[model samples]
Target chain A: MRNPRTGWLLLSPTLIILLIFGFAPFLYVLFVGFNQWNVFSADDGLVFNGLDNFRRLVFDDDFLHSVGLTARFAIFAIGSEIILGFVLAQMLTRNFPGKSLFRIIHTLPLMVAPIAVGAIWRLLVIPGFGPVPFFLDRWFDLKYQIGSYPDQALWTSVIMDVWHWTPFVTLTMLAGLSAIPKEPVEQAKVDGASRFQVFWYVTLPFLRPVLLTTVFIRIMDAIRTVDEVWMLAGGGPGTRFTGIYIWRVVFPRTDYGYGSSISLITLYLTIVLCWLLFIAISGRRKGEVE
Target chain B: MKKRFTFILVIAIALLANMSLVSADMHGWWAEAAAPYAGATIRGVSESTPPSNYVADVLAAQFTELTGINVEFETTSWDQMYSKAINDMEANTGIYDFVYIEQDIIYSYLAQDYLVNLTQFAADNPDLAYEGYDESAFTSFADYFKNADGDLFGVPMEAFVKVYLYRKDLFEDADIMAAFEEEYGYPLAPAENFDQYRDNAMFFTAYGENMDMDLWGTTVQGSTGHPASTYEFLESIGPSFGLYNWGINLDAGSAMSANGGALDGDTAVEALTFWLSMLPFAPPEATSSTWDEVASSFAAGRAAQGWVYGENAAWIATDESRSAVTGNVGVRLPVTAPGVIEAAEMGDGYIGYYDGGAFGVPHSSRNKEATLLWLQFIGQSSVQAEWAAAGARITHTATFDDPLIAEQDAKVDGYYTLLEEQGPLFAGAPPFPFHAQVREVIDPFIQRAILGELSPADALSQAAAAVDEELSRLGYGM
Candidate 1:
């Protein structure tokens, strides 16, 4: 291990960053959750309301609804990204004409900044005037206007996120695919394993670690995303999602104390959930060797 | 492990070093910013998220030229600015020398003494005093800027009113006019009534459908954030219930004006409901659109009508933009209720007014003298005239009154005429504490009604409950 002391020292920066950004802010938020002070108010003037804000968040119907909505959005968005990304990676792995160009074209989305992507999608999908409206009209011959339904805004947000982030999943999976040895697959085939069996058993097992890692990273990014939601719906046609809800409270209202509390709560939830997923996935594969 | 450790270490060191550079580059003076104010890197912030803030290069350069004070004007979207401002201010880090305090935010800032009171500063500086600034010139627009006790805490930063704009050639054309008048039982002479305005707007928009042109009758910014263009529909319906009216005195003395003239429950409710009913006619994605979105939509000729603001009048109406109908854009008066007073009974009135107050020195200013000098330079007729001609609309009559400014182009004249003619219907900022929170409820509810999520009555009722809650929280009248 090259001396535990030196090894620890070498890894100290990451540990320190994790402690400060990861843990400290999480702890501060719990402390802040009890107070009624906002950012505009004096920090000393923070009133210890003894979970009054949390009581509001936990008990309020809208707060609980958004929690449900967030869980639903995360599940759908992350799951879609993974499946679509894997499919895209699989397709690109095969030899084909214009394979390089296809790979580059798919990654173009990942290259664009999240905000720029959000802005472009907003322009394209605008209910009446945008290309999305045109595309819908041409495809279905029936108008799919964003005006009639409020909840459609939430769905549109999901589609935009899928478009901008699936490529990230593809890249991660492609890297995993490259790390697998061709000999293992050939041996499986020689043993009379079907092509589907070779992929389902041999190829898939090797890619398990990568899949788990990608899902973990993707879940974190998807939860924190707000740009597309902000640009597209403004948390409307009704305030339902956590990301937009946080932004709306902070800016025009300047409710820092409450806003910070919500942010901290989200961060804590994310960390705990991520930890649980890691342990669960790692537990399932404990007996297996690399 | 060594390679992994080194790789992580390199990224960490670079990130920390970069953060330090950003920190060093940032004006941390906001923490202890109470210096003599000169020879200091003063951090100033504003959330002018529109056609104006894009011209920050001009504002920063002019500010430096006028005061010899080099300002580090940090621009962020509204949320970040609010978050950073509040965080920095609470920390007492002299981070910001100047901050944009909307009229509504004054109450909280004043309650906590986060902002300095401006009464004493204006008194101390004779040249920058309110006397020379023409109080009568601002009378019709002054109520919204004052606190409950009549103290002016924050002056207007920037403001522009909404005007009903339509296609002139289309409105004058015989086919469209005949159908509108035929169906609505009224001649559409610039839409003196809401019935006429919507009916006329719809007529021109529907005519395009009939003409097989890719056009709609009218479009207004339907965004949840400030739906100023939607006010045309609101005011159109407002007059039906006495929800729209302001004092129009020939003399500026005793000169009274309503706070959007919304003082009572019925008027407030009526205004709220009447305002929302017009949203359905707007573009489908109006909920996300802000001022710029609305301007582009109108200019593209895809939309035949929009409630135009002076801020974009110069740009949207110009030929360089390839707007659907640039020169053909005709400015019309804001329409009122059906029977109160038609164009037949009374001529023109201020339909929807937004107060944009300029800078005044605060009692807590580190250098009140220097701040007032900056204020005077901004208020100076010559400078104001130049800014007006350049497209940053000031509230002062003199800026638009100047021949230099008014003659710059038809937009300048249009801006001048709108200010002069619409002075009667002016509504200053709603003098409320937590200006933002109050808006959070009102703006959303108004949009809900327009998008048909809530009926006009339901939206108003929900909004009333929300506003009442905010008012109670802010220690307003119980």
Candidate 2:
């Protein structure tokens, strides 16, 4: 009876915050999703078109194209962040001359703000005159660089995203890495196990839960990112992705119900991907426990 | 556990504090606070035109000096201005006292009953209406503003016609211009007809070697992924072809369909084909040029002539500014089509232009009283004359017709002559009730044709088919 009272007392603040900012909007989104309402006419009540919005998306070529682009972009961008993030986190775990400074530097991108990262990269990649392009051309004679073509622009946007966010993954992985018990590692070392063998067998298995969790979180975030891509390319060199595709629907042309349908599809995609990752994590953890 | 609860409590308080800080003052327009002397405070909005800045900052200062009323100006881009006006008016947001709208928005805005009828305002103040303002103050084409019942919603500011500009020095060369004039049987002024313009541009571009000039004859805006550039090209060529005549005339609609052609697959194909065929004569990379690029090309001395809006004049007058051929350029009317049938032989023989911006009110403004004051002040003969005199504003007839403005402003003479003689060439029409839908159908066709993704004929036909589908969905009678 005392624990129940304490639980209620402890959870009230969080529940209230989530209720107002999170649940309220989430509930309103249902009404918005069902109607032909727009930012201009949000007040003029719902048109009650039922599943008509979703029905249109089935035949919409732009929707299909955006879905494909998001999958491809997320796979490549998230893959890079995780691999690089894991390596950096591992390096930080070891003692080095400037380990403290390196740890501080790792957190710098996270602290600088996402908009600033986008602005900095946008200037460097501006096609003809930007110094980055100038220097690349001077060295390699690769005149047409990443800023001009749609696919190249997508990759450049991804690289800038990775630059800003890989650090967050590194910080999480560092905590996960440090949390591992020392006894198993000590035993492996005494038993003459090599560093690579010991890491693969002992350390990797132990940290699999945290790494999977971090990767799952990053995947969800990568799908929703609009601002960085918005600032970097303005979704151009012509839009080849979901974030920009959704923006075009919401703004420029105020096709509200259709845009809401696209957002709903994005939410579903996020849940399905993260759920799959969770299953894999559970299976791996269960194997280790056995 | 106690410490964690304390931390969470502090975070909740902090979040609430932050939210309060970021919230905007959402009280609908405060008429009393906005206006101290007048019965209501007037809040006006205009697009970020250079003249609007002058009016808001410099001229507003003068207006305030003359009449002590606190007025505030809200400004944004032309696109933003129209979208906001359409939204604010439709929703009755009451955030603005006066809104500067464009012709496109005016069509839709008038369809609704938000605008305060100008009849009462004009009747109450006769000197403010036609009595003080003369025909000279306005372009000849001011009749469009009259509603079906012969009522005015907004006042005309200026007659905007497409002024075909070229490098005078480049045209002055005898050897090059002699051949052009002899072939065309007129001065090598800008093309007066669409066919003549195309042929003349082709000749100039091909003989670039003989002319000893590495210049193309014409450039057009293609870069921006919208229908505005297409609309410019369409308006310039449509009258020549007789596609439309001042809105869809039900009596003449059949003739328009047969003679000029319908907005069907074939017509769409023909439209795209014509514009794409002229692509080579544009800048090498004109595939990426918008209206800004066209002006920049002219300013950089890269092209002989091009299509651009009138605001470029402000850019040109600043000699140390971005324009390369600042003082050397002159303006004229766009070219029309070649004579085909005996009757078609006459062609339209005129150019085309669309309106920049106009004003409208929303149904839901909290500050309707204050907004009415600004609307009246903006429509006043004295304010119009003053704005025109500054050389920065296009005049509504009430303002431009004032003899005081004509005497005061030098830039008004050249522009006035253009408006008087050629302003009737350009007229305003609604694109479609559902304009967003129209762009959805129109943009891909233009984009594809310019990118060489499809032949002009194929691209246009498909685009027309798409637009028709959208129109059918909207239940349009036409």
Candidate 3:
């Protein structure tokens, strides 16, 4: 007594919505990517430029540099966030006075907007005047213009990203830790295993999926990071991330065709990275479903 | 009979007086013409500057009261304003009725036909033109937004020159002067050349160090991460060194002198090199500073001299709460190298950047007539005086002589006198349809030079090559 018409009707709304919201724009962008389409001077229909737009990307030094910078930023920011987030999550899991207060305090940074965090850090790290430079100079004898020097500016952005996003990873890790069964860990402890050994042998294996998921999410986010870096150094001091670079190409240059082509490249790169991570995660446990 | 005649005379006089008051009414005419478009709400976007904020918060409401046409003016940062306005127009969304057309970008807008021809629109609907609206009242600044054929494209809203602001207190100090003269073998005064400027910067910086105070010789807008850094170099610093029209040679249509342009010529290289050399003498904040921060540094007495935008000229001199050196600030035309002024006067170059923007009706706007009325309302000569004083920007020729501005001239150490006398020396950005594209190609290289990633000569050479390549790709110099 199944009505095929009814089934089709039920799915039609979502199908239409997706076509309009997601598929249409994607297809239009694909069409634009193959042409010399300047939106401002778009009088005659898009001129067919074949792969010329994509070819331009190969020779664009700024674009290539941005892609490289984004990778470096991603590796530094996410790698640090994962390790630090896990440690903080573990510290919070232990029984202690004011544990809830500490948990709340630790998550405070996540509530703030990324751009605001960047601005606050910009103020803090300003040399000769900012509190950060003052304290670091007095306490550690470290004196440098943090946001003005090319090397230091990149590292400063990484630090701000970690400060703003580490809380998300920690909260996710804490949830996973709470859900893990205590039996294996307790048994290991009773068998005279040290704290580190018990955690490594019993707790870590169980937490593998959660760790992979959090890292994957963080990596994806780090690849597309823009706001904080924009507010802080504005992709300057030689720290032009992929996001800011693409923004400049599209808005300032107004070369929608070439910008779309570049954007498609980034999209494909992210997809490939995510696919590899997925495969690695699945292979870690032979029978586990991701 | 005599009492009856007197009563009639009194009534007649009262009626006539009321009639005369109505005749002189400014908004009464607007109210009559706007009857058809009353209650129509027009949205506009502009950078969040003093004049824009004033128009949004004060003038827009008054306009509504007079014309019954509501204006929803959204003031935002330059990037966001450009993005929103351009996107809306590109998409033909009719989301915005008016947009800010900066003098630099008008050429691009004109090329794209994104704006409605103001002159044509005015002619098409003569009924919509307000009584106070007179296109002739505007100064030559309006020419920046007009086509070669003399068709008006936008209504000039704000105009100002970027001038050099110095700490008069520091320059006048007897001890500092004697020390400077003893070291440099010249009287310590406002610099007239690059050499003098450099000596002053070095001398004051050393003086500050000796005194053990948190002060610097100059404020350099050297934020390598933002467009402000690039703008400062190209507009303020480069012009003084004789790099006019962005060093592009009109005859050869190239940026490289070998190809017959001056973009990478000796003067341009020296200009950028000198600009970067100020890093050591500037406040540490210079590396992350924009025009606003530079003004703040000068106003707070942290720096002895800096290039400050005219929009900030008034507040830095008049507003005590915000400006620490309110009473001791001096303003003058930026010092230039030898032959620079004469060359500029002879139409070979420009001395400084004449920065400003205008309001134009977007073609995608649903209520073009309503938007046109709003532009006219603001463009009226009577409104120019108050807006000029508030924003430190003047578009009308008569605004230079406004009593309020004249009064403010005395407060800011004759900043207005310099503006009135030397204003003709500066000019707006060259009318290039590829302005944004060329700037984008040049900005990063300039930023790299400031960050010490490239030598001045290498940066300029590379930038010139990139710009040449881009121009070719866009069919400019092919």
Candidate 4:
């Protein structure tokens, strides 16, 4: 659309900003990952320790446990979100009374900040004062205490994530659903095909790309979740996901070297995961073309 | 007789006039010293505790008004405050003129040379030294902020012990007393030993259950994932069982008894087990409670007894709007195991944590001269009484005798009296430069124990091993 030099000049500012804020820190963290640097002990500057931090990470039990916890969280949270989001999106595709109001109400949770969401859920589940516990105790004689029960605390965080993020999935899927052509469904109906058959053969194939994209995004986000969980349970008991584990190390412990090493490992693992999903999506598209 | 009365009156009048002149001279000194930096805006950061809030809202404004200097004090959560201050100092960003240094972390700061020696600073700049400011006016707690050479690095702002608080009304109730005595074969009183404390906890818990009340026996600061839980075990509960200095032998660089430390010794295991045993008697919220929540739980009348920080004692005993057991709150020293109190008296150990903080001028500060004035202003005897009343923390020895504190002493069931007389028994955290690092490694094990993921014996054993490994890695005792 323009001369090459003009385009390069116009993009220089954004490229420079990206280099300064994004690429520079990434390179610094990578460098730090190979060194022994405790902020309190950093007056002597970074001590080059080669792969020592990475070597230690291999045997770090707490970090390993946090990785497992994050994996579990991602699977449960993203799984429930996708299924629930698809169902909601399907329902919204149909004409209904107060549909606009329902959409607005449903999307409100997505608008709340992650930190606020965590605070809100914490208030909802706090013992004695929280209505969730009060009602559970009154109706079912159940003692719903997140502070004591690790399993309950973990599940509560999953539920909180679901509540906060399902709206995004629903809206994205709804857009995909709306953009689907009507002719195939009409032809399927004309052919005396059942609703399940039409959905499987016509509607689902068209929605596959959107579903893949949504799941990919959710997986990336859920794996890195810290704020809401930190706010809700404060990385307490069952809620010390990988992100919170890294935060505890870097900030509270001030173990910059180990924290950097763990962060890089997590980043690499995340990239590998997205690559696999990307391969799956690309492969599926090629198969469809055939 | 008239001549004698006239002579006495003349003497009194002259003394009063001299006092006013001295006060005026002090204010004049502040103005003259601050004249160089009159228009400069000095920034500081502290945790949003009552004392720090007083410094921000009241003292800052007063200092500014007196000297025409602008002060911007940011009071935030404890974690944020520490992270911000440490980051600024480490980076030499000069973002903060002064920072609150908790008694526990002052050693770390001193080791890093992150703070200005206020004593030396004042001595070098004699013109800026306030005549009214005296370091001796502070309680012995001020000694915690001194470096190896006995040079002052921080001005003590707040100091209080973790005291045992119980429900006076319930203890005094005839029926409750009879029931407790019938069950325990002793008169119900503030516990004097570990066994008595446990018996009281059990009896009170059962009594509350039987009476269909919302009371528990005690509050436990046992949040499984927070540092508060570690502090409860190490600083508060462990010392009561005669395990001191976090059971770590700093000289030997070990936490294992075999290596000359008592971290995993029998007493530490017993301490942890005894503390965990109270969980059944603690309210459902105990597992989630930190120091703040423990205070709130006691104030709400949900716990009949608890080891509460003294900073909360005044409010829990007097603030009816926030406290349900205001008039019935009682304060005492925590029950210690046999020989523990003796050890504390001999200075071989401590009974519990003496928690407080002080303001220090960071070495990275751009306005050290101006900040010194603010620190001294708060350190003065005239400001101590009101600040102590507002914050339930007394750093100045004279504050306990002030009329305001005397009135507060009655309302808080002589909490100030206990602090003044018994504060020496409750020591601050050990002077470990690796305090945060060691705590982080050991905290998970303690959390595991709290959640029943590990037995008390196993938790302490593993924690001891972890601490030893960490200390060795840090080249301690090498």
TM-score preference between candidates 1 and 4, better one: 4
**Which stretch of 10 consecutive residues in model 3 chain B shows the poorest summed lDDT?**
B469-478
For residues B8-74, what per-residue lDDT tens digits would candidate 4 score against the true structure? Answer: 9999999999999987887788888899999999999998877888899899999998898899999
Q: Rate the local accuracy (lDDT) of all candidates.
A: 0.61, 0.61, 0.85, 0.90
Which docking category, incorrect, acceptable, medium or high, applies to candidate 1? Answer: incorrect
- TM-scores, all candidates, are 0.79, 0.75, 0.93, 0.96
lDDT of 3 by residue, A1-290 (tens): 28999998999999999999999999988989999876544242478899998999998888899989899999999989989998999999898999989889889999998889988987888775689877886799776675467878888888889998999999988988998998888889889999889777677778888988888788878887878888777777547898888888888888888889988888888889988988876786665434
Chain B, candidate 3: TM-score: 0.93
Q: On a 0 to 1 DockQ scale, where is model 4?
A: 0.54
lDDT of 3 by residue, B201-259 (tens): 88888888899776788889988877888888888889988888887765566799789
Ten residues in sequence with the least summed lDDT for candidate 4 chain B: B469-478
Better of 1 and 4 by lDDT: 4
Clashes of 2: 17
Tell me the tens digit of each residue's lDDT in model 2 across A1-290: 57998999899999999999998977776666777754323133457789878887889776787777777778888888888988999999899899999888877888876667776876686543357766776698764333234566678877887888899888888898899999999999999999998888898888888888888788877787777776565554344467667766766555666677778878888899889888887887788789
lDDT at position B327, candidate 1: 70
Q: Which 10 consecutive residues of model 3 chain A have the lowest summed lDDT?
A: A37-46
Please give, for residues B1-478, the per-residue lDDT of candidate 2 as tens digits. Answer: 9999999999999998876653322111222223344533456677775556655776555435434555677766544565566556655777676677555555545655567666555556443343333433443344454467766666554335555777776777787688877776776766666576677677677667465555776876664333455565455545445444322233322112332325433443454566667767875435545455566666776667766565564354333467667556766655544442222323333335545554555556665544444554455455665455443346564444567645533432255455544555565654334555455456665566666776866655565556555444443424
Model 4 steric clash pairs? none
Candidate number with the higher TM-score (2 or 4): 4
Better of 2 and 3 by DockQ: 3
